[model samples]
Target chain A: MNEDAVAGEKSLKGIAVYPGIVIGKAQLVDRSKVKIQYQYLVNTEHLNGEVGRFEEALRVVEKEIASLKNGMAEKVNDLSFILDSHLMILKDNMLRDSTIRAIRDEKINAEWALKKSLEKIRKVFEQIDDEYISNRISDVENVTERILRTLSGKAQQSLSEIDRRVIVVAHDLSPADTTELNLGRVMGFITDVGGRTSHTAIVAQALEIPAIVGLESATDVVADGDLLIVDGSTGVVVVNPDDRAIIYYQEKKLQLEDYRSSIARQSHLPALTPDGQRITVMANIEFLEEVTAVRNYGGEGIGLYRTEFLYLRSKGFPEEEDLFEDYREIAELMAPESVNIRTLDIGGDKFVSELEITKEMNPALGLRAIRFCLKRPEIFKTQLRAILRASVHGHIRLIFPMISGLQELLDAKDILEQVKMDLDRDHIPYNEKMEVGIMVEIPSAVVMAGVLARHVDFFSIGTNDLIQYSLAIDRVNEHVAHMYQPFDPALIRMIGRVVTAGRSEGIRVTLCGEMAGDPLCVPILLGLGLDALSMNARSMPLIKKIVRAMPMSQARDDLKEIMGLYTVHEVQQYLFERIGGMFPELREKGYL
Target chain B: MEMVRRLKIRNSLGLHARAAAKIVELADRYESELFLKKDGRQVDGSNILSILTLACPKGTDMEVRIIGEDSEQFMTELDALFQGKFGENK
Candidate 1:
């Protein structure tokens, strides 16, 4: 690195994605040396000494990797995927063979051969034009740095601690950087080469660090020992910020802190309307680790617990014992509190690693949720066994998704029975009286609800999918997504029918999708006879506040007044004015 | 003595770059010296191209039994890693 080259580089500015201020030394992630090493490796040698060199080089690389891993462990939330890469390279054959050949024929040293071999593979990735596949540059640089340092016999220096807050800027951070980072001491993160969806961003978000990514030369602009401020919410970073700017932002920071404490204080209080109506606030969890959020958020119980997370990091089926362990943990944590577990809703758009349910032209309409479960009775049975076994530990309800009709329901129920009988035969304990529920997403379920509701214990309307299917639009397809309206008359009518039918059968009716969490639809759903509202944990407190502000009678009346509206905009505006007109403070605060 | 876990490239594309990288990644995570074997011959599991060279096609089940401290977790993760099509493009 030349001093002139560093001086010639210009600064680039962009929005900061997280907030805080700190000044720290710089750690550059350089890979140019690896490129040079690659260019020099073209020869080969076949000798015991050459083989020994390769072995020695590998040991050095391994040690560097170990030291890096130790350095990054506490700072990162998840380093499994990153470490997994190193493991693969250490055992890689093509790289070893190519390097050995380069050593034997090209007459290159082990370090150069390794670099050259990695470059060739990296070039292949670059040609693919897929970021997901091509983003192995970080991994390559990490491995090269380790191997190079090892061969040079240089002891790795200990990373500096963040005694005061600081901003970390990098080309891209390895999992080691994440693990080794002292997040409490660091203020935020800004990276030049990582995507928002990349592992680096995921960790930064988990640590609640303000992070901005995809900047071209962020690391070059923010100098070592220069003061830097990160605004996480707006994704803004300021270099050597003025005092006035700092004072203004300091107030903003204080306000945010106040709001956070207010939200926390309200968690323990029941969400009710000024007029006495109560709203059920529940938590949605993807993993058992998130159960803590439910308690922290003061949620009533688990509304939706996605079971797919258990299968996410594994290749085959999760061990029945492991699955049982996780389920039991949740059940025990929420004992006497109901937790609704949805059956594995894989296939369609979601490709399960172990089971690739048929790829279809229309995944949302194809074999998924209930349909997939019915097709693979055994897979369904295993989950059902685990859920049923878990039920004995607490109050648990099993919900089937993507239900279109009676037969899918019947066949699924049949499998559930077989699982129960098997458990009984094996003398395994389970909650025999566990409630069964169905997500009314398919139009057929809505149309024949009166007949279908007779057999179910509860019906939860999954409005996100229901709206997409009802409009014949793909919610994920950006072009047509806007046309998928939850407030469409047809969707409203379907929801009305399902809720009415459920009440007639003496079955509880709930809305568990995104629609359940929306403040605008609260009164409309209550007017239509929805008995419960289940939504994500984050939105629970605010929705509860909305529910508590309105009287049931007033809500029903307001719904009746707005029901005759023909369009979503008309309905939205009418409700906004009616609700906001009464609560000016809430409306002014953007609570609507 | 080190043991090897040999899994053929069962994905549609012959151990495309990402899949190959994934295999290498998984092998390095544990204490084992993992290798991919083909027809009684073994190649380093950590090398991206050597694993791809085995050219194990879709539906081809390659054995990946390991011997190391984290062997069980390694083998289990390897199974998923191979099956994911290495975050395939398209």
Candidate 2:
């Protein structure tokens, strides 16, 4: 009744990663094809003034970037060289001369002239075949966008300028950008690119802001200030909705809101089945910013603290202190709660820090994770030292990623022991008995789980990589994505074995992957005897709601029944049918 | 005085932003008018973006020209930079 929806409506469907509904104004943050509201010629009288306006905007941007570079330069070095190139782009005479020429000779406004210069430069860049060099245009485009924003006095695209709540429309919101939207002005998200498991969806769900991802064209279609009805529950986004759609959704919003609050009230309670079996629900976070969201979602501890953001965000090698500051902050925030810090799992092809002369042939199988760390012990020790130092702050645990065999596991542990001795001799205090764990994601590791379990304190099954390696399918390749099945009986059998291995060794085992977050996969995971399930914090409540309803005694039997069926389709069907019968609410129109 | 030199881009990344910025920074010191030519296309050697548009990858052959009172001195240092691979070998 309160929110009004206009006419000329169009609806778009996408994978709804989070559940909620909101109607708000749209704010487009697509920096690629910047939208300019004005493009008019300047009068002869104001021609000089316009040129001066352009010059002043350039100066302001120069100072803005210069100060930013200086600020980051204090804590880190060498990375400034990356930001320094932006300064060069901003001050490049090619852009300056062409823009000023267009302003004076063509009699155009500064914004129009700047855009014209940008288009010309882009044209020149488009001819280049090198993907890396062609990609550098984004850097130049970013600088030009800043200049345009400054010229129009709208330089504050930092989202704080928005007074009213608006849904952000973007190409893709990275982990950093997702957390930065903690701004109260932003209500929801509609991104053109992202999967159901992206950090944006996880953050949106954890923050209770509904999100719809993989819309493919939301950024291009939604204009600034256009009325948007974002229904994350139904996985539908209605653009410029009419009156009937608004009234219908308004009531649906109220009912869903009531249902979510009821779930939230009991989310913090222990996740125990009627048969008295308990499971620990934890959050898998990559940045310090998500720690509060983890706790707010009733996550008991950090299940997987992915440390790749340090390398990814900087687009260069981050220093030890940079790693320490992030690890320390997350540890302090989640004090008394065990934070499992997984050492860097990023591949070298994506790594920008090393002066890569030639990219790897196949990075996923090439020098990555524990393999790369073993080769570059200095890079490895840098992270190990930081993690060890931060372990003094909270209940921190170290988990090595992609350990294919006992040799890699023992070799990585040898380096960790060496780092501890180095720290101890220097009188640096660390947890003398910091727990160590390995990701039981590799098929070999699963086969040798009994041998692998004896050496580590815990086993965290990384299903994302586990399914990929075991099934031998690239998870992102659309042609075989359906083949990358989570319910593949082989993987279920492997997880059952890993849990069995952990129990034999008297150590706890957890599942920390997308499967851990999936509602359809929860009962099977419970029946397999996993001690904990660490997933996107947003999925905790939904998973808990399912766990709270079913008794573990029945789930163990359900697992045994489904395990008898070998094919993915049969197992998936059996689980879905079981879930439907248990909670008929899940059968309501793509509710799963 | 005018001077010209032919050089090979020894750096593996070619004329990327950092490498081009190095050339631009070196050009800033000399009074010479500097220009770079590759495959019949010439660009202002001191403009980073202009130099980048050349898109010379590693092993590409290019020519450098300097015209001013500082031409010879600029040529000497430019040759050193070319041979040094813009200090990126590390």
Candidate 3:
């Protein structure tokens, strides 16, 4: 009940998309409760006046959209394209004429007529087969809703009007709704429906705001102006927390800020052990624009560029030229530092409808990554050719993802060789000496790392998948997610074996996974003799700070003891005790 | 003075909102009464909703009719848009 939550009785749990801690008053923007009443015009003489009223409402909505566009012009580059479409919809004579016609013929109020016009447009949009175009219906609905609100004389309630900083609790925020939020006055946001990859979540991350999404009853339980604690790191939302809980989180917030500032100060410094051993720290990026973040956080190079985004974001297969241009730009930007381009790792969570792959019983273990690429060589070759062509521009390295065995690795490389031969025949210039590598994410890959290492230049351990496959747990499934342990003895042993295997083959081994970014796991990974650590750009500075503070000799010694531990709990306990003392910041946050 | 030209939508996305907006923007610049006819259903070229109501996808053939003093010049410019695929490659 809202009463119990407001009385400081309970906390809600959700998915943590962006990490931070914030305490603020809750501002409920319940758009779903806004009901529009359909009213009919009683008099015939009011027809022209009704049409004029509708036009006036349209103008007001247009001005609102224009102001919104101007407000976000500097913050977001891609917003203009969406706003431009909204402007077109507002200026649409078809919408205007039809609404006026309906008002005259049906003797209805402007709101009802506008709704009718929107319905006609919605019907047309529904008939369209294209997914991208059909999605535009939301834009139309948003614009029309604004107009209807204006027609009904509802005063605009701007998020900017809040006198103090607040945490927005909403059913869900559209991209436009999220943009309208004044980031300065808003500390964070909690939504009832959305995932990490949603537009609102991405915008929240860009704004550096704490956000907890997919909390089904966030709006219902959290009352307006109730003091709320949003722990985005742990995905906990304490509605009207008790004094003690507030004080604790407040101290944690300060500690987090202090920790962040300390790491940021050490960002430009090299990631090195106290014993003066340099450990290369690179970034794993999904979008090309994130390179700026990578550079800002002091990543030496791109360790893994997830190329599946090219397919996921596209309506159909991305043309080779477009792919080439994007790759070339990133390569040119990071000139001397290598860009390890991972070939298309589609299927599973990242599916392209155009691929028309049948639904599998278990997508994670099904035909995906290297298997998907091998099955669709035409698509794979297009990406390979683009990467090969871009290789000449900078230090480019090709990495194959989800290689379960030596045969899959060889088959993928064979396709690459075929692509290279085609490029040679076509007189396309590329870096012939571009390094080829495989992601050691599969248990089989770890077992065959020595043989696989001999066939490649490097090994990047994708711990997220490796732990999932090794422990036989789907990380995304909440029921089994608790079993997905990174500190499991089996996972640690497998990773250690892969590191040794790469060393035996005289090749560098890197960890480009969630575990690599985790500060508590960094000492153990460094001790395991990992040549490099790659992670999200945001985590680079903190990891680097931890790595710089730790002595390689001590970590190596601690690793032997850690490996000897029999269970995940023992290994975790050992790491907590050891890493906690070394990094007091981690200790204060209880991360260790 | 009426000028008519038959053209095919070349852009893969057909005449979606953006493309329809382009046609309307260009059509509004002239004094001619521009009408777009597809499969016998004609709508005002200057109205995006009417243009969209035609539901013209890629490869759909349509007739553009302009009736006014500047009909010839208007037809020429409209033809250019069709040929250029409204500046959208995909």
Candidate 4:
């Protein structure tokens, strides 16, 4: 087998978690610890004063921990427990006692004493022979980072202090490091080393940050203040980009930024085609904080709320109250706006230890989402009960995920009925009239949409998974990720089948995956008769802008003409030439 | 000395809750006032509010603190929780 050769030169590439091009000089975020020996050498003449210095360092460490915890809690809900643990470690009496002893007995400095004790902790973790335990070494590293920064008297100036919008070039960044970056000022990231699942990469994706990692010598190649062009979607970073390329990119970036504002202005407006057809645009969110997107970004309501995130977090099942309160909060927030909650799409990549939902031989096709929920009827009922209970607070619609065929649909309905019976028997108040829907993810569901449509209130096509399952490809698999095409005629035909099926039965049809948010696929989805489009709030404005610019009849005709042709590349090119300037940001991001 | 209390993970996403609540729960079970630490930072376990601030991810090992009375027992149980994958279902 011929192995692909690694690029030896300095290069930068990472998944475009966030989209935007930023070019500026390299501002290295120094998270490294200071040398302990240097501290001892400086303080050798004043052994008595070293204690006071150590005490001051300890105080600074404690203060930083408190501030860090407080800051993190403001953005994310409950991660401070780890910070408390770190505070205790920084103040650990045993570690402190031993370090103090070492300082006097071995003539070692405070940093060395701490480092020496930390070595023992690493050893203990190493003996456990587990990655989870072993990774705690970072905790030590984090504390050291604080202590060293304090010692160096430069603890307060973090990555965020880089006051200009520029490409962030680093050797590698930790999750904490990535979180601290001022997203507005930071245009892109170029790291020397990191994989797709690295904390830096994951955070970048969630923030919609344009990043490129795993490029060796990226720091050296891109000097401080060098003009660089980062293509996050393609994991490409052009250092000192040519003048012509810079001019092209600068114009493209401006157009994209302008389009975003324009979209923001029209967020509240109905997505009306030139021919006067209206389509509902909804938002997809993973957390409660994102609820504001509905009003701020012009979403009718949440199209899909992946409930598995709730299940993955708890040690056991989320209490009925837990699910109830969560759903209720989301519903009440949206109030008049509709919220479609997708029941526990756990299993596969999403796992919960208490669920006892074992990984299968093929997790993608195995017991997951609706299949897993159906297997454990009691669990499904608990969720259904919570969703139905919350329905009274808002216009809530429930959707089931990964329905392969009609049987699964029937089984889900059966469970929903059982939940209704349990609630009725208990005289629990719930919205009995709330509509139910199914996610058309599997090819089997897409093919039998007509039959499946009859059982559900609506059809929200999950195009991300549908395309993956249809092509037998994983969008994350670098080698085959290219194979994961959104506009493939096969997928277009599949979506067409579901849309036609839903329309035939008077069922509302929507697309709630990344594809729906895509400008290229927007016109096609409209032409195929999709009732609504739901996606990230960020994409809502632009999608609405594009939809409003086109006539429904013209869009339909154009989609028909394009679909008749063959090849993914052709489909992309046609969309590029047709919808080019309307979605300049999408074009700048190289979605074309 | 060690004091131990059984606490179920209440936060969504178990140990990985935005504040690393499980780690905090383990640390709070002692008089020395345990801390579940990551990097060089310490999160007080007994402080529900404090622990919820750590943001440790799922399957992450949190540093446990056992300061005063019943420190030994709390340490043992906390160690077991980490060893047992925080009772994570397979």
Q: List the pairs of residues colliding in candidate 2.
A: none
For model 4, state the Cα shift of residue B2 in Å: 12
Residue-wise lDDT of candidate 2 within A31-82, one digit each (tens)? 6555565555647778888888889998999998787676662433444665
TM-score, structure 1 vs. true:
0.67
**TM-score, ranked from best to worst:** 3, 2, 4, 1
Residue ranges of candidate 1 with Cα displaced over 4 Å: A1-85, A91-93, A96-250, A348-350, A356-362, A472-489, A582-592, B1-52, B55-90
Off by over 4 Å in 2: A1-9, A34-88, A102-136, A147-163, A171-185, A199-208, A219-225, A348-363, A472-484, A566-569, A584-591, B1-90
Top model number, DockQ? 2
> Which of candidates 1 and 2 reaches a greater TM-score?
2
Q: Per-residue lDDT tens digits of candidate 1, residues A410-482?
A: 8888899999999999999998889998988888889988888887899888786788778787644434544
Task: Indicate whether candidate 1 or candidate 3 has the larger TM-score.
Answer: 3
* The best candidate in terms of TM-score: 3
Which CAPRI quality tier does the interface of model 4 achieve? Answer: incorrect
Candidate with best lDDT:
2
Q: Score the docking of each candidate (DockQ).
A: 0.26, 0.50, 0.43, 0.08
| TM-score of model number 1, chain B | 0.73
Q: Model-by-model lDDT, in order? A: 0.66, 0.81, 0.80, 0.70
Give the alpha carbon lDDT tens digit for every residue of B1-90 in model 3.
998889999987788777887788888799999999998989888776667767788999999889999999889999999999998765
- The runs of at least 3 residues in candidate 4 whose Cα sits more than 4 Å from the true structure, single-residue gaps closed, are A1-57, A72-77, A93-116, A129-160, A163-256, A308-322, A347-368, A371-382, A406-411, A581-592, B1-90
